[model samples]
Target: MRHQEGLALVAAAATGIQVGAAMVATRFVVHDIGPASLAFLRYAIAVLCLVPPLLMSARVRFATRDLLVVMALGIVQFGVLIALLNLSLQFILSTRAALLFATFPLMTMIIAACLGREHLTGAKVAGVALTVVGVGAALGERLVTESGTGEWLGAILVLAAALCGALCSVLYRPYLARYPTLPVGTWAMLASVVALAAPAGMEGLFTETSRLDPSGWLIVLLIGLSSGIGYVLWLWALKHTTPTRVTVFLSLSPITAALLGVALLGEPFTPGVLLGLGGVVAGLWLATRTPVASSDNDV
Candidate 1:
């Protein structure tokens, strides 16, 4: 493969790993901390990790108008989406959460169509149907075996997260076109940190400082590092590839999360899960192959 292709593949794989592990780790840390607090710490640590790079790069200036747009993106993407996703973990399994979150690509396609960036081809519609079927198959088995209100709630929150995430992806391109990716990402994260600080502060960042066990601390560190690095990789890939191509790899996230659940949490691997995984992968491939106008080339 060419160097850019190889890098895109690497970025996709890294994002898969980061998102999968982050899901599991968030569940672990949420055991000790509330979802809001955990979200705060995750971004706070990520902001700290990003600052060194931000300082080293030549500063990118933003107009007053664009500052609000970036901040809005940050609020929706990191603030609302992440907080809802973490809250969903309170009710759903990590695998189920990941599967629901995987719907973002289809959501992004729909958003693109609405924005006049792309037309929704029939293949893309079919892909979305297949993905939804797969997710239903996977979760249906679990719902039959062990049903609870919390699990359903989690699933709903994850769906909401997917919607917000799609919006963020659609909104990011204009800023990315005009500004450096790293700087744009840095500001977005910084905005998230500020937005989350108040609610997180009420929970007492210092008080929880002593509450976490050693393993919990390790999980937090991994979440922080993965998030910081993952955003950089995602932004880099966005610079080089179409959003649909980048979104296609997101289907891999649930598979990774399922495997992690089996390895880390001893969750049983069922045939239904396998079938669902296959469906998700196949659907994403079909969706990505369906031509949509490139975001970069759109009006």
Candidate 2:
């Protein structure tokens, strides 16, 4: 059991890091492709990768109502979330976008609390406050230096994307309990691809795709493959561990994005980022750490 828990933690951490790297890669190529187009291509390729595993697995059936609900969730989670995130990159640095997105777990906690699925302990409330302050610190510095509405627009988009993720995280528990992770994830992604088609077409995806240089295509391929792999690992981790334990590992994402953004994209790592990162990390620890009595099961 300990070994399985350790593996789950590792898987969760890997997914978080993969997301940060994918963000950097998305920032690299988004200039050449429309947001909806990029999201469509990314998930379309991911569905291809996911389909093979699903085919080999034992068959599973979905009720008509459940199928429709899952498809709608997929459209919002993968379609709307990725489209918005990709769009935000056009206005903000990947590091900033990631930092802003790191609030996902906090948002999840709040949503769960609102739904009466989880209690808001004093620690949790404090953690939420700290995370909000941390995110504000990170963005406040930028608001001063940059002269434009783009930064604010990007911040709102990223937060909206995070909120979407948080809501899906809360809602997915029931469906995940009812289905195998691979089938659910693959079906969700496939649904998102179909949902995104109209928007992608509107952006001239067919025409713009031909213009991508080999390097750009390679990055897109990497993003798609990583997303598929990360999605599986995330689901597996969730199966083995509590959601708080799985999502707590997301603290690594902003750190990964910040370091990679500096090294690869030459984005600055300002003091505000440092302070924000510290607060976010501390907040996650405080927010998600189970009581000593529950720690054994949580792990």
Candidate 3:
């Protein structure tokens, strides 16, 4: 049991680091490619990566009903949610975006309660409030200093992405209950690729191929690899942990992004940023500590 617990901790930590690094890589890719195109390539490459394992997995078989549901999840999760999130970068700083997305735990809790999957408790509510406060504290400086239509628009886009992501999380419960994690993840990724390919192709696929410098290619590759591997780890972690526990780790993304900015982009680490990081950590702990059913068993 002790060994198993340690393994779970390692898995969760790995998932968090991979996801954080993926976000940084995604930011780099977006510096070169447009959000839609970046999103298109992400899902496309992810689908390609998934194909081998999917073909070999015995759990790959799906009924028509399951396929449709998976397709819908892909549309909302990978296609729409990711696109909106990428677009949000145009208006918001990476740290701010990460902080805002950290609200996923709160959103998940509320949605689960509404769906009768969890009870609404005062502790959960407090946790949600703490999370919001933490995120606000972390990004408060930027919010105060930054003023523009684009910034506001970016904030709205990210919030919208959060809503879509929350919906996807809730909707995935049923399919996860019926299917194994890898197979479902593979199909969902395929569906996202199919959905994005139509519009992306019409825009002239590979038009930007000539424009990519070595660094751009490296960033794209990182995005692809990180997203593919990180998502798989995420699915695996979901299978072994609770939703709140899985989501709480997401708060680390902003902190990771801040560190990355300091290391890679030469961005300064201000006191406000540090304070915000503390808030985010506190909020995540509070949010995850609330009593909730483990939704991960099904996934």
Candidate 4:
């Protein structure tokens, strides 16, 4: 049991890091593609990637109601969340977007608490608070460096995106507990693809995709592949751990974006980021010190 929970935590952490990397990649290609178009294509590719595993897994029938619920979640999560984030990138730096999106854990904790699905503890509250502060510290330098009339809009969009993800994360618990991760994730993502289709068409996804340079195509492919793998890891982790435990790992996203910026975009590494890194690490340790069982009945 301990080993499984440990692996779940690792999976959650890896998913967070993957999402951060994808954010950078999305920022690179978003200008060339409309938000709806990019989201459609990204998840379309991700669905293709997930289809193989879903076929190989033992099939289980979903109740009609559950199917609808899961599909709605998929639309909100991959569809709405990615669309909002992509739109936000037009107005903010990837690091700034990542910083704001890092609020996902706090949002998840709050929603889960309100839903009576999870209890709040001092350690959990402090850990969530510290990680938020840490993320702000890590990306605070860039907040001033990148500003525009749309910056506030970008922040709002990112927050909305984070809220979508948080709600999905919390709501997914019962379904995840009831179903296999691969099928649930794959089906949910497929639903998002269908949901995005009309919007993608309106945005000229077909034309935009043809115009992409090889480098841009490469980035999109990477984002899709990572997203497919990340979704599975995320669902699997959530199936094995509490939502707070899973979402708190998202604190790594902004840090990953910040460090990647230094390496790839030639951005400077500052002392504040270093201090933020420490806080994130310490918070993770404190938040995850006591492992909660994965059962949905726990409250």
Backbone clash pairs for candidate 3 read: 138-276
Q: Cα RMSD for candidate 2?
A: 3.4
Candidate 2: deviation at residue 42, Å? 0.6
Worst 10 residues of 4 by lDDT: 290-299
lDDT of 2 by residue, 1-299 (tens): 56776787789889988987898788778998899998999998999999988899999999999888888889998999999999998988765787678778778777766775566577766765676566556544554565444888999999999999888766776677678889888888899999999999999987554567999999999999999999888877766655655665666676676667568769787887778678766775676554523432321
Clashing pairs in 2: none
Worst 10 residues of 1 by lDDT: 290-299
Predicted candidate 1 versus true structure: per-residue lDDT over 207-299, tens digit per residue? 556478988988888898789899878877766555555665676676676667778779788887788778867776666554435543453
Instruction: Give lDDT tens digits, candidate 4, residues 1-299.
Output: 77988999999999989988898788888998889988998998999998887788798899999999999999999999999999999987777788889889999989998998888888888998899888888887677777776888999999999999999999998999889999999989999999999988889876554667999899988899999999999999998888999999999988998899889989889998898999898888888896563443354
Q: What is the lDDT of residue 14 in candidate 4?
A: 99
Q: What C-alpha lDDT, on a 0 to 100 scale, does residue 102 get in candidate 4?
A: 83
What count of clashes does model 3 give?
1
How far residue 23's Cα lies from its native spot in candidate 3, in Å, is 3.2
Q: What lDDT does the true structure give each of the candidates?
A: 0.75, 0.78, 0.70, 0.89
The residue-by-residue lDDT of candidate 3 on 1-299, one tens digit each, is: 33543454456557666666777777766756667677788877877887788778675567899889988887788888888898898777666677678777678768766776656566656766675676667565765776555777887888899888777766776776577877888778878877877666654555545355898877777687677776766666555555555655666666676677778989787786678677766765665554445432333
Model 4 stretches with alpha carbons more than 4 Å out: 207-209, 293-299
Best by TM-score: 4
TM-score of 3: 0.85
Which of the numbered candidates is closest to the native, going by highest lDDT?
A: 4
